[model samples]
Target: MNGANMSARLKDKIICITGAASGIGRATALLMAREGALVVATDLQADTGAALAGEITQTGGRAIFLQHDVTDEDGWREVIAIIRARHGRLDVLVNNAGIGLSGPVVEMSLADWRRQTAVNLDGVFLGVKHGLPLLRQSGGGSVVNVSSIAGIKASANAAGYCATKAAVRQFTKAVALECAAAKDNVRVNSIHPGIVETAIWDSLIGTTQGARGTRLEALTAPSIPLGRTGTVEEIAAGILWLASDESRYVTGTELVIDGGRSIA
Candidate 1:
């Protein structure tokens, strides 16, 4: 669609996105802002997050940035308070912050597992726990939790990552059911992205053997039916649908944005 003809799907909505400094989170932040949402972009990388918010403002969109550590309950409280004070209500929350720690289950340390769970699974719980009130105050909204394809399919070297993402998927369903039972208008869903072209791959597969680009292509070629990795923008598009009113009836579901990798 042309820029002028594009629908403002999230116009005037208040959206808070975690891990907004880079990758799918970054892409989502930009797209949501363009669609007229008041974007609050948060990430551990203060400089990059600030730059993203600044870019949105310079382009005539409304946005702000905050350094957020999603694992901290106190930090979440502060973030919600900021939204309440500034925007009065939150219309959407994207729990997109996550880490990928991979190793054989036998070789992985307890600390590693705990860290992965803390960010990927626990962070989503905290976001829903704290953000729900504001969403209700806004008269109901949506929550999009970013999981992974590993959540549905298992991988030998990524036991911890898979376990945490799987937990996120179930947690999303539980929250969706709870909201429905309570007669709340809020909807909850999870997005499982396959091999997206993001920097996370660098940490998942180290570059010692060859160039990072070559390693990434090799990693995705064998399994992905599309013969290539997905892009952050593609994943963000699904997230946007979940966050916007377009998916008003969708809840307690998993939106897989893989290149048919999970099926293959």
Candidate 2:
């Protein structure tokens, strides 16, 4: 089969991505649009998500922006209902909204723990809970959850964040098995990223050092084994593969895009 005809893999497929205001989520929206998916770019930042959707529209790609708070089950349900009503099916669901909470467990409060899990773990759970039916309606689609290298391994002073991300990894596996066992034609997977140069990283640095200039570069270049942090586009490409038919046999796998940091 011609690659064009055979692998317009996502042509006309509807994909919904959370956290689309910036970082990996934004990148995925653009990349998926380029690959012929009807992208729904959503985030709490209404302005940014709208701008991204507009850009895609200007480029002659189909897209919509929905304001979403991942922690709100009602919001997630609304999103799916609207998508189904408007677009008819949800082919790909990307759970990409997350926050970076840094502090030692001893100093971390219940609020901190809850906040992290609410967005990272519980948010993913909600997506799967609500999205599975839609994905099955598409005759089997991919669910890509954004995890972290921190999920696979622990870091110093990031107990709450690590715990939530770890939950996402395991949750993806468990859910993938559930889908397969039900033979529901829905695939679930996770992406584990290391120090990716995202707005989240900038915000984390701003919270700590009060300046993201040199500190950001140092974090990107020094610690990672590849001598550089991953890019949002790089991570988006991984998501595209998982969401596309090329990865049909690849469910429940964690695609780590951390510039080889996990190898070290």
The lDDT values for all models are 0.92, 0.87
lDDT of 1 at 91: 96
TM-score each candidate. Answer: 0.96, 0.94
- lDDT of model 2, residue 147: 95
- lDDT digits (tens) for residues 59-161 of candidate 1: 8788999999999999999999999999899999999999998777999999988998999999999999999999998999999999999999999899899
Which ten-residue region of model 1 has the weakest summed lDDT? 1-10
lDDT computed for candidate 2:
0.87
List the RMSD of every prediction in angstroms.
2.0, 3.2
Q: Identify the leading candidate in terms of lDDT.
A: 1
lDDT of each residue in 98-215, candidate 2, tens digit only: 9988866889889878988899999999999998888898788999999999998898888888899999999999999999999988889999988876668654566343455457
Give me the runs in candidate 1 sitting further than 4 Å from their true place.
1-6, 208-210
